[model samples]
Target: MAAKTYSAQHFVECDQCEENPAQYFCKNCPGQLCKECKTEHKNRKITKNHEITELNTKNEAFFGPLFCTDHKTKQIQCFCVHCKIPLCTECIIESHNGHAIQKLTKAYKEIQDDLQKKKEKIEEDLLPKYAMLLKTENLKQSDFSKQAQEIEKEIKAHTRQLVRIVKQVGKNATEDFQAKLHKGLQRIVDSEVEIQRKIEKLKQTKDLLSAKIETKPTVSSFEPVNERLLDEFEKLPVLPKYHFSKFQPGKIESMIEKNFGKLPILKIDTAKPNEGDSDIDSQEEEVEEEESDSEVPYNLRLVQESRRF
Candidate 1:
């Protein structure tokens, strides 16, 4: 729309007509590369490397210049489909000379057609597979949620039961120890009372014996005490730790095949239509014709691979 303006000292670059034209003509991809720049653009090592589109033309630039690797000066205008490289007419007499050389324009169109077929195939075949994958994942997630919830509930209930058992075991052990403590305390109390009575009798008898005269020795003492009895209560067994299974990552065996095996195709029978449905019949015929014409027969890719003889 708006023309490029330049200062009086310097001239504006023209993209279409000429260097410093009266009016700016058209634009290319990036910052306006002028028409004068086209020669420089084509000659540069990096710019020559790029698929540079001309600003003035509708033709999209693909695969730069298509120059013959053998013939440096020549633009490769013909593609030897057998050799699959661009070749000038002069190269025809060389080793691969006799092979088929289709014009580059036809080759380009043929490639475009092949790519279109591939794109459509991806939509027809792989797209449905992708959608099916999504559907399967969603369904599986729902099922897993339901089942995992049930499993978690079961695990929680079992865990609570185990905890109750552990608590009961602990309570029983504590109560048993307390009962043993009661017996030990009673035994110690009875022993202390017996000793006290013996001491009091000895004190009275000793006072009398001292009043009479002094005698030789005395009786021995007992060994087992309340501390020894409590040691028996201290030797109770300990409770064990709780364990659980972890959730692993991967598709379950049964679920794997259902998601991955195949893309489904629907069966349909074409019925002959009467005069009233002739329009539908014509459309179907046209579609079939287009489909047949548009199919990609075969071609090698840009990448190379080993071929079978």
Candidate 2:
């Protein structure tokens, strides 16, 4: 039933009682109080001096108005430009006498306008750019992964091809080595057979001379036979010479490059974009301009910043 007392707005429960619709706002305690709790709150020694006002009349408190801390009866009418604080009539006569003053309403309007413009800039300009950037980055990441997979497949295929080529090369080299070895061995074997035949012939001649000497043969006959054997021995063909196959190793690095091709190096671009082209910097500059032009006080700045989240 107490909610009917409030204007056309959401009903709020008293901060103290939590059961009744709030009808009053305590400036000093900064609490919402219902009509029933307001009397008790005022009776309390700690809250008795607090400035309490009807909720409907306290609308300006939610905006940018404040009662002076020095003179509790007077509302802030001016802003001390130098100190960047809300000023009451008493504040102007005291410490802020010579300080640059601006109307509190003007300052509040300027802060509100600046905040609105920043909000519009974020929504219209920065948010869309960031969203597009996010999309592009996601696509780029996917593309990079796809390209890497493709390159990996190619590398694997090349490696298999190189393996097959190397196997064939090794097989061919082995076959060639075997052929040359056989040829060298065959030459040595042929020379051995020829030398063995000549040895047998020389043995037969030696036996015949021994038998003729045993029968007391003349010296003239033996001399001719011995001379012939000596001539045959001297004329015997020199052992056939052969050079065997030997393997000469090549450079491994050169072989790898020649067979499989050089592996690609990983390159990364870590260089940042131009400062002027940076969106973050541009947004920061805009925020700085908003702060400078509005000359928002600390509390108002806090309020503006809280709205961003």
Candidate 3:
């Protein structure tokens, strides 16, 4: 049997190829290549100048499922700069045609760059405005609380004043009623004493005659008089029922409204966009779908605004 000699090339791995066709990940390649295949692949004019490194996608996070502007059925694998419409490579010749289109990864990075700048602007300007709004809300709440306290105190004082008036009127009526009651009692006592004295004298005179004598009541003793005096002293009125219905806090009412008016609404003002704001608007940017490559794409998505009432 003859001994076979093995070549060094057999042991060495292939160095150049495409990383993934699904991702359109031509990491500088025309077909699928592992980390070893990167060196031996045919270096094209465009890809020779392009950068390739170890799969360090840990930093490069992504979001997708983008749509093709022209085909509508084709998913957006790439973005055309001049046309500003995303398209798949199959539509690149038919839809994008001759226009320059870059991979969606590059486009995403461009968006990220704008996003980073916008984040800084939000920290410096936009976030502070939110903080200011919170502070304004707090101040308004404090003012409202103060107004509520004042109103409460004023109402208490008003109640006390009305009560005092009722008490004063009741005291005067009670004093008059007491004076009339005392006079009525004294008149009744004097009449009882006069009747006793008269009866004693009649009995003494009748005993001396020793004859049968019929006693007759005198008309003067039961004379009708002063019925109005007894009616006046009856003192039967619901004294506290009458009260001041209209409470006046007229001065304090204005202050209460003033406190409530501290809260203001959002006004219409032209805010200048930061350097990357146009890019944020672009993310919301719409691409028109057409029948073929001949038509122009028109954007129609309007940015929504948030309003505070």
Candidate 4:
């Protein structure tokens, strides 16, 4: 082989002699080696398989570290799996003795493959799937809010209708009660007027009897007035008793409450897609129809009591 050339500025001294300019760089010894030193390095049993690159083939600045830190004259050729560190031949025999070790190239290839697999999984599967899941959850949240609002509106409308009905019922019941009360009161007033007339007649007859006695009028006239007074007194009218019927408002409230209780469990039929239909548009249409079909009817009856005053 032709003698290797060395650049003046890029020249490295041989690690063994520290005299001649280095011609070969040993990746295992990780040090510069002159021609003489290279011969000696190859002869050594531990460094026989060490990779050596010609320094003259490329720029010296691009070359990586050729010598081990702990073993100054040795190169990092092996990796210690246990400690996860690079080692020279001497390091392997000394500190990393009996540990699981492999060539740096072999460890590099294996670790590179593992990292590539992880990157592919993240880019192709994990990240996309997670993003889709996030989108679905957001849509579900929006749907939930929308459905809740719609149900609330329906509830308010139903409640207003119920309130109107209750109010009308109450007004009608009040008017009916008032009419009955008025009729009862008028009958009582008429009885009172008749009693008053009889009292006045009795008073007049008594006064005539007194006048006859004082004047010493004829006995026949006084006797007749006394008899008429006794008859009017005996025939006095008795007053009739009256009372208002009890109106229970709580029964109406209870009926409303019972109907309202069913609101939570009221079944709204949802449209289901046929098993044979696989079209996405069909599925969406079915969902929309089901949503539109969902209806909760307020089934309530007015509670009223019947009583006579």
| Most TM-score-accurate candidate | 2
TM-score of 2: 0.40
Name the best candidate (by lDDT).
Answer: 2
Clashing pairs in 4: 28-75, 29-74, 29-75, 30-66, 30-67
- lDDT string, candidate 1, 279-306, tens digits: 3543221111123343332111100111
Regions of candidate 3 where Cα sits further than 4 Å from its true position: 1-52, 55-78, 82-89, 100-106, 164-309
By the TM-score metric, which is better: model 1 or model 3? 1
Q: Write the per-residue lDDT of candidate 2 for residues 25-55, one digit (tens) a residue.
A: 8877777888989999999998899888877
Segments in model 1 whose C-alpha atoms lie over 4 Å from true places: 1-66, 158-163, 166-309
Q: Worst lDDT window (10 residues) for model 1?
A: 215-224
Residue by residue across 1-309, what tens digits does model 4's lDDT show? 354555433345678777777778787657778888899899999998988777642233213454566888886766778876667889888889999997665554454444444445445644454344344335534553454445445444444555655544444434434454445446545645564554455445434433432221111211212223243344323322333322223333566533432222211222222222333322221111123243432232322321111
Candidate 2, residue 39: lDDT? 99
Instruction: Provide the global lDDT of candidate 4 against the true structure.
Output: 0.48
User: What are the TM-scores, per candidate, against the unseen true structure?
Assistant: 0.34, 0.40, 0.30, 0.36
Query: What are the Cα lDDT values of the candidates?
Result: 0.37, 0.50, 0.35, 0.48
User: Model 4: residues >4 Å from true position, as ranges?
Assistant: 1-63, 66-74, 81-84, 98-100, 164-254, 263-309
Each model's number of backbone clashes? 1, 0, 8, 5
- Point out the higher-scoring one by TM-score: 1 or 2: 2
Error of 3 at 106 (Å): 4.9
Q: Let me know the TM-score candidate 3 reaches against the reference structure.
A: 0.30
RMSD, each candidate, Å?
Answer: 46.9, 50.7, 49.3, 48.7
